[model samples]
Target: MNVETETMKNEAAPEIRIGGGVPVLGPRDTPVAEVVHACHSASIDQGLAALAIPGLNRETLEPVLQYCAGLRCVADNVSCPGCKRRTEAQGIETLDQFILSKKEVIVGDGRVRLKGEGTETVTTPCLETLSKQWSGENYWFWARRVIRKLRHGLRRAHMRGEPVAGEGETPSIILMEPQLADNIGMVARACANFGLDDLRLVSPRDGWPNEKARIAASGANYIIDDARAYGTLEESIADLNWVGATTARQRDLRKPVLTPEQAIVEMRKRISRGERCGVLFGRERNGLETSEVAVADAFIMIPVNSRFASLNLAQAVLLTGYEWMRSDAGRSLGRVTTYEKPLTEGLYLGRDRPATKEELLGLFEHLERELETNGFFNPAHRRSTVSQNLRTLLTRLNATEQEVRTLRGIVATLSQGKGRARKREE
Candidate 1:
């Protein structure tokens, strides 16, 4: 009779706790099932090897590979020498072996084994459910997504693209209790300016998912659109093992609060070691509350004057982002040196011919009329002075043609007042 016992030791899964490497399955002769699980969960190289072979069903797949690594292999499809002749042979018939390449296969004959390399990779009909259909446009998109997923040894998405040294993985950012739309827009801009695209917002104040935020976001609309809104902070960061909070004031909890530099060091340490981490930025007015701070594994402080330590929500984001880039991680995450010259070859063909005299006069007339409407000209003040002041502000920015037009519209609206423009007496 086959040896059997209830509750056989399975040191394979994390469930088993044994000192000094004693096999969890008792004797070295423990069952194959327990042996397999132990080896698969151990590391990157071995786990994939197990997936490449057959025999263990998907259920037992993880466990058997976890333990059975470096164990003896079958010579033929049938029989192990340990199982003697004249006795029924227990062979693994479930091995649905596949070729790593078009040319080679790992095969075992009774008492003999051989290895051969495949010249070309075999095309097994795409087996996974989620694999996308191939298309020309997708070729580029998937390549970029794949690049985004890479963990190390490559130029990061934050930098200009490079030959694949490796891939960089973008981390997620979590915000708690946002009170203002401008702050949200600024945060969105910060995320886009850096490499972080995953934004999670919890319990927003006033109105969010509104037009005002979209307007403020400007070029960062995609980031704002992709942002995830949650009901609470804990739920927001639940998946992250390492959490950091930002604060400007003192609190009762003794949790370590680090300066932006120090926090980046700590967060960098964990990230390099493959820990999932998230940084929390609190509301605009009060910053993160004590309740929210309690759950954080660490705190990040922006060093500001004690008497005047307050910072706008977006300004804090800028500092944190700048620090994040200096972390050891920032180095490997694909930092590149921008050259003195532009990366592209040339500027637009018509970059600057300057508008004709007629165009310039027309622009000034439109602008003056717009300024006159928006209270840019006080009823009691010198109209020419007010108009000049308004002109100076726009001039300082060196407004582009398109931007000039948009500003004119806003001014025009102010001048015409909020009432609907009259429809032609229809």
Candidate 2:
């Protein structure tokens, strides 16, 4: 069988042949969802050119490109087969060869036009429809991320272990009906930030194990990898003995309302007695319904300006995690590594002690002597008062031993003028 016949036999749907025998995944009228799936499953070597559905130009390609693992010409620079062969013949294996040899395609104002080649132009769908379909989703930026991952591998691929919070140490963070995958990724990062280990999701709108969430997670792969998604809120919190729902709006429920600090404290107390505790966060658009809030043992209300009480999904989780870690006995002020020690609340004096009384007195005398030589006291009657004022000023510095020595050196240098003054005296 020929390549076309073999290709058609293998494909689930009829292939639309383009660019002289290159197999397009579907017909010209293929839906956006199928196009996206085809692009994701397409081999990196074949690229977007092979999956040429109608209206699959740069403007409409972002949503498809983000899901793709490897598409060699996903950038503004479009690579042709001839250029690839030429570069390969010259033994150029780097990405620069492909980038340098490709033609530039300009995408803007609902049009995709090739600049360097024959100037092929394709008009895209209306902006309003695009916006409604993918609100706040930047597919082009996401495409770059996909290209980056294809080149460098997944972010923090080597990091894998138990959660930052040890077994049963921190409370499980539960997100209810999170709409955006990016928000979920950010929540994972926040969980990693303050040692909150477990992350549970109930009916995420974008579905679980999404690449967008993984990309947004930034480097909290461990949290994203282990995050559990349940069908319902009840199933998510089924394992926990006590759960607290976070809300900014006032609810008429009789459940006790506590601040983040108080909730963390209460959870800690319950966990000490071997109870599994969790914190429930609401959806991004609208918070938990009264019934959902009612299911929780207590409702947590973070202190905020009454006018603007709503917080971002990740922000709520971050605040709760911060409170959980704030009172930890082993917690450091910041990151403590091998060469950097844990800091406390005080003045940091490294390798130097406070100035001794003798050192301080010597500084005072030296300063006073210099002032006397310079006639800074003005009247002789005011000499005692001026000297007393100068002593007080110097004493208030609370200088270290090294600081005292440096001040004395500065005074000597100013008063005597070093080598020149000695030569003039001689």
Candidate 3:
């Protein structure tokens, strides 16, 4: 006699667990019924291999290939010899004969086996309701939802462990008063894309534990599940040792301003020294206010067209994350080296160390003194501008220690010539 078991609501659809693991039904949007029909449409003798009881179904068209792999083919019939012997030993008839006589069969567990028997139970777990749907209102919508849920479930079951962020010195992303759950989820996905995991939120407009965010996150639940929410911005970033505020507009603050590339270098430097760092992202509409910017130690500005500098919150986070990964990834960005032997390797490679600020400042003072004595600054009011111009010119060189000393020697020789001319005139 066939035994039937009641399936609980919101429970897993009946599935043949393969190798003690969840069965992979198929790829995303793979029709489950089609796979079942394909497996049973033709006889095994006609080059049709029956699917195994428990296995992944990547595509509904393929069904479960591993299922048929286990069955032994004998006399135009695909059957499990062991399973047939077990059931027959248990005083039951052949599995195929039993399936032909019964519509539903109950296994040892409470799970309802919709099809097959013995070692091969081809059953749909949580999709029992789909067996009744023929045609009606909102059928496709419900079908799509069910399919999506199944796809996610299959993916979850196949994974041996929860997905984690990549290993690196990724900075924490802090969202201040974020408005949309969609944006938050997108940001989490972007963070995952770049190996970033630490996500901190301050006063989200719709509050926390948002379902929409989880749905939007796709498969990056690790970030959403472990994301921290705080009441105020201060509380959110209180533990961070260094914070960089991302802003598009130029501010009058005295804090150091750096492009994304430069900011990542500094961030990496600090992280290497055992300091925790984070980036502050403002709301969607208006960016961080003056007070909020003041809390940050530095500013990170992405060089974009000034006319339209507005960037989506997720985009900004993605760009920053990309730069962070690129910083230490040893990725070459169009760096060129000479393939041929150089004529003058000494001059080019002699500069081993950069010139110290003090050395550069001393050179600047020495040159400025000689210039002042020679009346180079004719217009008294323009002295400051002239001095600034000279400093700017030197700053552009990024002179090395050797280069500074050489330049100082040149300046000293020129001063000596002027001194001799003045002495002769006297």
Candidate 4:
């Protein structure tokens, strides 16, 4: 669930090449879509080169239409890499669909990524209420930035139900297909109160970047890391040795919907036996869908009025989590920090600058050749100050990883005898 932060990214256009090999366009002329399309094609180099040339207009892209008119045969053989093992059987028909959808196109290498048209908006009861609470729910819109941060944090590191250790118990909280951002945040708060750090949201309906969720989470934001969002109900409950389903209406499920007390007793028994198990909760409204109850090992229900039974999202999570805690499994398992890249030494005056070894050597070598070629360096008497000053100037700029690579190449070119001869000829 990576959120798209910036709108209208300016990408370099694609490059054109003949069918077999050969580049035809300069970098500026490369078509952006062609480069993106090549990501799906067979060969990257050839694909990139092909992208440089403009494809026929959408109306003119049909090979069959072109062939029928005796212009050119359209190639329908290319397949989409996203769904592999399946060739693009739709041909021109599929192309029309893509045009209609206006999918994102980025070309390079032999792989093309399609951030398909926006996700479908489900018209659930939750949507209407969520819209009222946190405004609209567009993942890419500028108004929804906090939501993007949450999405970024989740994607940068994989989240899981943290393992339990020591003689303490672990807390459990379930979020059934939370569709709105605010609901997820409120659920996080409920977990915080009952000492439940782990959360499971099944098949998130709204996707991610839910600002309402972050605003609602308040202080208990870290559980967002422990919150594991799944694609299906079974997947959400798979790891739990004991499962409890939250529902209001009576069902044919053999398992009973015990009050919070009865459910806690069973959960405690399971935990005492040193087993992993949890009590589940359904979405705020519409409760648990029929399919969700099918896989439950047991059922847990919150009794409400027969006519009006809607409860706040946080209230439900708290109810279930509070029940789980009663069984002696609702203690903090201690905080574990997951680090992304480890720390490293930077370029220093005494220890030497970053890329302290090879990059420095390359930089010096490059500088000497450039000076010599431009007649800037007096060969008869080399002045150390000149070279040192040059280094100081470049180091201050803090050249980027790519800039350094390019500079090194320039130096290597100027240092070669053939290069010098060619320079003289030019």
Go through the candidates in order and give the C-alpha RMSD of each one to the true structure: 23.5, 11.9, 20.8, 24.6
TM-score of 2: 0.68
lDDT for each residue of candidate 1 in 1-426, tens digit (9 for 90 to 100): 333222222223332223232233333334333333223222223432444332222333334333223222222122111122101222222222222212533222223222334453222233331022111021222223222222231222233322121122345678788977667878877766665666788988745564345545556776777777889887888778788888887888888878878877776677678777778988876788889888998878887889998888878877777677554232433333563322323333234443344544456678776555555566746887766766566556544555555654564555554453222111
> Candidate 2 residues 323-406, lDDT tens each?
988978787777778999998767788778999999999999888888889998889899999888888988898899999989
Local distance difference test scores for all models: 0.53, 0.71, 0.65, 0.53
Question: Which digits, one per residue and each the tens of the lDDT, describe model 4 over residues 362-381?
Answer: 77776776777778877636
Cα shift from native, residue 129, model 2 (Å): 9.5
Global local distance difference test of model 2: 0.71
* lDDT, residue 9, candidate 3: 25
* Top model number, TM-score: 2
lDDT, candidate 3, 1-426, per-residue tens: 222212222233334322222222422322233333333222221112344322232333222332333221222232222233223434544445544434555443536454543455333333332232211123223234334443444223232223343333568899999988889989988886676889999999878966556656666777888788999999998888999999999889999999999989998898888788899999997989989999999999999999999999999999998887676555333323575332331335442688899999998998898889888988978988999999999988988998898887777768777577446435
Question: Candidate 1 versus the native: TM-score?
Answer: 0.39
lDDT of 3: 0.65
TM-score of each model, paired residue for residue: 0.39, 0.68, 0.43, 0.40
Give per-candidate clash totals: 28, 0, 16, 21
- Candidate 1 regions exceeding 4 Å error are 1-171, 328-426
Better of 3 and 4 by lDDT: 3
